[model samples]
Target: MAATSRPKLLAGRKVLLLADFQFEDLELMYPKMRLEEEGAEVSVMGAHPAGIKYTGKYGYPVKSDLCVDNMSTTDAVASYDALLIPGGFAPDYMRRNQAMLDLTVAMADAGRVVASICHGPWMLCSARRTDGSPLAKGIRATCFSACKDDLINAGAQRWWTASSCRAGGPFITARTPADLTPFLHAIIDEMAK
Candidate 1:
């Protein structure tokens, strides 16, 4: 008997997962499962090539798929249909990486869907757009309130606070992991569009 291959809903759609330090475990896992459930190919990318273990706020370790260094931002951003930035301390770590920021900027500029939750929007904030503006400027978005405050204080114009909100362009933002259901749904919908 031959083994059957997994069905591919996102047969040609590739997704890039960016993580580092800590990220809400459930937030990352649920979307990965949902996307894969619909046949999207998901690849995890982080700072280390050996794979970084995701820890919760409490420091409990979680598994990762691949390392960011192993994959080039030029390649992943260009090849993938969308990019998923999970929130937590991980976004803080991602913000410091130039390659990650560039890839995010490229994905958004290319009109590909860029979905984020919790603190994930920080990476978006780091990517300076062509107009010398934050990628999220003038775009309605939501993230961990703590991070939202930082964006607002930093002069990120047009940011609005909400439990969950999807804003201008192909961006979806959620306040926390609890807000992931709608966030994931929006991402799938955007991919379909």
Candidate 2:
């Protein structure tokens, strides 16, 4: 009747990559590659069925590993140790999907780490889980600075403004693609714990 514990680091962790039409290419691929290098299994999730072709903000094409519709929400995402949301227009698209939001909420509630880059945190805001709540209320996290400012200037509330802010919960947000290395490291570290 004793509880079993998860492994340290991502020796055998499963990471869910969620995206839409246009996502930061480097931000998505780099972390996915890095996590795989560390013995983690990486899978792609998109709004389309046949699979989503990712485009950079500048319009360069990026290929995906799989489609969201190809796998069941309860199957593809349910067992992952973490969720990675790369920014760009993708998170915006993802925000509209109830299934994606539910998966994110479930991960955070389970105390699993959720890593996001660039405007990726926008999905967090859409999930309504970034409102200084117990899940991500004040954790030292960060996200794309200009985007955060734009949200504020546009009168949007519930966005993180710092370059790197952690809200004292399970969320980890970073400002840009340049923050990927550290952000992925942090996520790996958290999952390892």
Q: Against the true structure, whose lDDT is highest?
A: 1
Q: Per-residue lDDT for 175 in model 2?
A: 80
Q: Could you tell me how far off, in angstroms, the CA of residue 30 lies in candidate 1 after the best superposition? A: 0.7
Tens-digit lDDT string for candidate 2 (1-193): 8987654457878998887777888888888888887778887777676445767776766556666556654664467888889987788889898777767777777777788888887766666444443323344555777566544443334455544534346777788777777787787777777
Which candidate has the highest TM-score of all? Answer: 1
Instruction: Give the per-residue lDDT of model 1 (tens digit) for 8-109.
Output: 566668888776766777777788889988888887777776555766665656566776656666676678999899887888888898778878888888
Q: TM-scores of the models, in the given order?
A: 0.84, 0.76
Question: In model 2, which regions exceed 4 Å deviation?
Answer: 1-9, 58-66, 69-78, 129-139, 149-167
**Cα lDDT for residue 149, model 2?**
52
TM-score of decoy 2: 0.76
> Which segments of model 1 are wrong by more than 4 Å?
1-9, 58-65, 153-159
> What overall lDDT, based on C-alpha atoms, would model 1 receive against the true structure?
0.77
Candidate 2: C-alpha lDDT: 0.71
